[model samples]
Target: MRTLEETLAWVAEGTALCRRAMAGLDETSLLPGWTRGHVVAHLAGNAEALGNLVRWARTGERTPMYGSPAERDTAIEAGARLPADRLATWFDESARALADAMAHLTADQWRSEVTTAQGRTVPAVEIPWLRAREVLVHAVDLGTGVRFADLPEPFLAELRADILARRGPANVPGVHGDPAEVTAYLAGRPHTGVTTTDGAVAEPLPPWL
Candidate 1:
């Protein structure tokens, strides 16, 4: 990813983008599996969860992102039912609070190790990437038409690297297209019109997150 400033800027940009998408949405379902409220609620919950990790890094405590998987799911579900205006506010406010926490981190805190919900131990610096990925990727998942091609190149590159590292070596023949499209497909979004070395893909690789 880019410098922390640049990465945090993307975080802001993504938050704005998501807020716009959320604002334009009605109580109608998001056209696939979820409602706009559900997606917005998830974003809010995610910002709070990521903030927990940031606090852990700053204070040298072992704060886990979520209390438990079940609690996380419950929060998202209940949050989805909140009024649209309040849900959007929660989304924006949580992100701002997280950014505030990030801004106060000392140099030493940047290198402090933290545990992710998935049990991975990584430097606190990775928290921004986690937020950026959630905001951008899940924005697309919102079905707001924020396609993969809309994501910035730098974010896509880092996202690709993160996903590949997690999934290990690319075992299947690779999908080919523009860098953003390939990254999108690999990151588990639908990348229609993309072709594998053997032509049309009958199956996709495992998800990135």
Candidate 2:
């Protein structure tokens, strides 16, 4: 298992990379597919939510930053129009706060369970990793041309694991062929296979979000 410090570092680095990628964009670029802005906003909201989770883990409080899905969506929509600098600042601050909290956790604390609003229990140690994955993956979803290869290897590996574990073969669009092809598919890119040994091909991703 990875250390909490390692997970925190990865989250910090991924957030920084995402901020850099979103820097200096005009409204047109920022609003691509009507999703670029929403993607960034969603990430910002995720940072806040994960930070709250860290706080709750430390304090044994069940406090939640957003009360419902509607509230979370409102937060994201409001954050979408924030200036690039402000967005970056907010993300950086949230990441730092989360990292600081994680740094003080003991191994026992890391494994402690926290109940989410959905009533599912999760380990503290997994929170940062999940947040890192969210930041990195959604950065690509912003359609700023950021590729999966630009992400850190450890994150990509984690993403691979997540896709394999959470997504069924029939449900994963664009997946076909070998492991490399599957990786590419999950990254929202096209892949070609040379042999039949490669696995079943699937439909392309839907155009609508």
Candidate 3:
């Protein structure tokens, strides 16, 4: 339930973080089995796919994020293989296009129902949250330096809530520590400082994302 303005600012900042992390880098990302090139390409592909949803909202045409799961995976792989300079341009252009699409949605259009790549139906207003989550989380996943602690506090809480809502409660032992600590655990990121309510170490959790 974030306001569009707030989400846009967060996306912009996260995009900047990602840009810095991927600059001149063709190395491994924090994500296993993904290079920085893979990460950047995925981001660029995601921007375009999500734009499809926005277009559906605006024009009442039914456009799914991708034609199929295989199509999506293939697209990411193809983009990842592009030359480094071309890959950067793809990300930059796609990001700009998505931002522009989000900015131009009318009030009624924002209320349009759109199905996510995950098959969940949500209002178009949720698009911002979806894109925000991508850039912000992937920025940290780039592992060039950004961490959960660097994210806005409110967004952390929102992310935590969203994860729990989908994953069904914080089944891990302990109440956990700060928002960043809990969010880090939920996101499957490396983190310390999380402990149970009674000072016991929090149990490791299965991947939620």
Candidate 4:
């Protein structure tokens, strides 16, 4: 795992970038299949959900990130219809609330194991990266034209491997491309302009996440 300081910076940067992506744009398909409002709502909800993991770490209780997938989706939909300013407030405040919850964890508490929504057992130390992943990846998913090339290379590498694992992909094969584009392709995003090792432009890849 990365140091707490580094993970905290990742969380902060992701939130900041998401905020920047939402600026001055109407909620018109910002996430392609979803609106800007929907994406913001989901981000806010994600912070609150991830905070549950922090709570579990601090208290040694089995509080879940969400009760059920349906409820989670419903909550996102409810928040998605909020007026623009209110949605923005929810975004900012939810992130802060998660931070507050995390700040209460002691060193020992930080090592507590938790069951993620995926039913994987992981140390509480992973929460920051989990939240950061959602924030940063979905920020780019907002269709704001934020290029994957702008992400930190280390973070991009992690995301690439993650998507590939979930997607059941093989090796890089005959593909060659800018690191960012390859990472985005791995994330199941629009990865235009990436080329194969044979110098041919690669085709659109499947959704991995």
Candidate 5:
């Protein structure tokens, strides 16, 4: 786990990566069936939704991330249709907004409970980690040449642990190697260098998101 300050810095770095990758919005992304626009749109919406949770923490209101999963999906699809420049603007503004909200959080506020889109209830401090994962992973998903190796080691380790915790060793069998390679394999991203305990190339895993 990261300190709040470290997590905020992580978010900033990931956000910068996304900004650089924004130039490829019109192109196909690593995510099959979704363009880079779709990925960025989802990131923008996610930042805003997380802002709602920050507000909930600060004010003691129960602000859920989204009204429903379908609502979140519809918003992402609609946002993806915007012109490229506007889509970039949307991502920038939402990211800044979420960062600002997180920055203003009191220590007590950081500990306040909030529910995730996946229905997991967690403290507000997890928001930055969540946003970090979003910006960094989706930066690669933009498919403009960013690779899993481009991500920070600490973040990748946390991500690998999270995937294993959620999906389990049974779901990601024969996995062992460099942190980046393991994370890439676990995330279902295009990867190389991952190997099993026997030193053989690791098999591909199903979707992990």
Candidate 6:
């Protein structure tokens, strides 16, 4: 399992990469697409949501940070309009708050369970790790050219395990073959020995979001 400090560092670095990537983009680059400004909003919203999870873990209450999807969407949309510097500031602050919260957790606290947005129960220990994945993966989704290979090896290993264990949506894309191919596929790049007969073709790494 990843320590809270490790997770926080991942979020910080990923957010920085996002800031750099967005610095190079104009309004056109921020428009809607597979990888777009909306994705950035989603990431920020996710951070807030996870922060709530940390609160619930600490307090044992069923408090919600976002009352509804519409509210979440509105926050993200508003964040999308922020200038790059302001957006980066927002990202940094939110992530730092989350990291600070997680850093205070005890071992028993980390094992506590809470209800996720999907209405499923998950351990608090897993929340920060999941959020770290969200931060990095969605940064890629926002057209940051960073690939899985660019991520820390331990993070990549953890992500590979987590994705394989989950049964929900394939958020990373392109996983129709061997493990190495799956890794390449999820990284948003095609593997040399892989072929897609159906489903979405694995777009190149750091896709033109």
Clashes (N, CA, C under 3 Å) per candidate: 0, 0, 1, 0, 0, 0
User: What C-alpha lDDT values do all the predictions have?
Assistant: 0.80, 0.65, 0.86, 0.81, 0.88, 0.66
Local error of candidate 4 at residue 187 (angstroms) = 0.5
Q: Write the per-residue lDDT of candidate 5 for residues 1-83, one digit (tens) a residue.
A: 67888888889999999999887676788888888999999999999999999999999999999999999999989988999
TM-score, predicted candidate 4 vs. hidden true structure: 0.90
Question: What's the CA error at residue 140 for candidate 1, in Å?
Answer: 1.2
After superposition of all CA atoms, the RMSD between model 2 and the true structure is 3.8
TM per prediction: 0.91, 0.78, 0.94, 0.90, 0.96, 0.74
Candidate 2 lDDT over 51-126, as tens digits, reads 7777777777876746898998788777777777777677677667766777787777777777554566788778
Predicted structure 2: clash tally: 0
Instruction: Give the worst 10-residue stretch by lDDT in candidate 1.
Output: 23-32
For residues 1-209, write the lDDT of model 4, one tens digit per residue: 36787777888889989888885435564345678778888889889888999988888889998999999889888888888899999999999999888877889988999988889889999899898788888778777867788777778887776776766656444567788988876666777767877888776665543
Residue 95 C-alpha lDDT in model 1:
89
Q: Would you give me the overall lDDT of model 2?
A: 0.65
User: Model 5 clash pairs?
Assistant: none
- CA lDDT of 23 in candidate 4? 57
Winner of 5 and 6 under TM-score: 5
Q: Candidate 3 — worst ten consecutive residues by lDDT sum? A: 167-176
Error of 3 at 160 (Å): 0.9
Off by over 4 Å in 1: 23-32
The prediction achieving the highest TM-score against the true structure is 5
Model 4 C-alpha lDDT versus the unseen true structure? 0.81
Candidate 2: stretches off by over 4 Å: 1-5, 24-33, 116-119, 169-181, 187-201, 205-209
Higher-ranked by lDDT: 2 or 3: 3
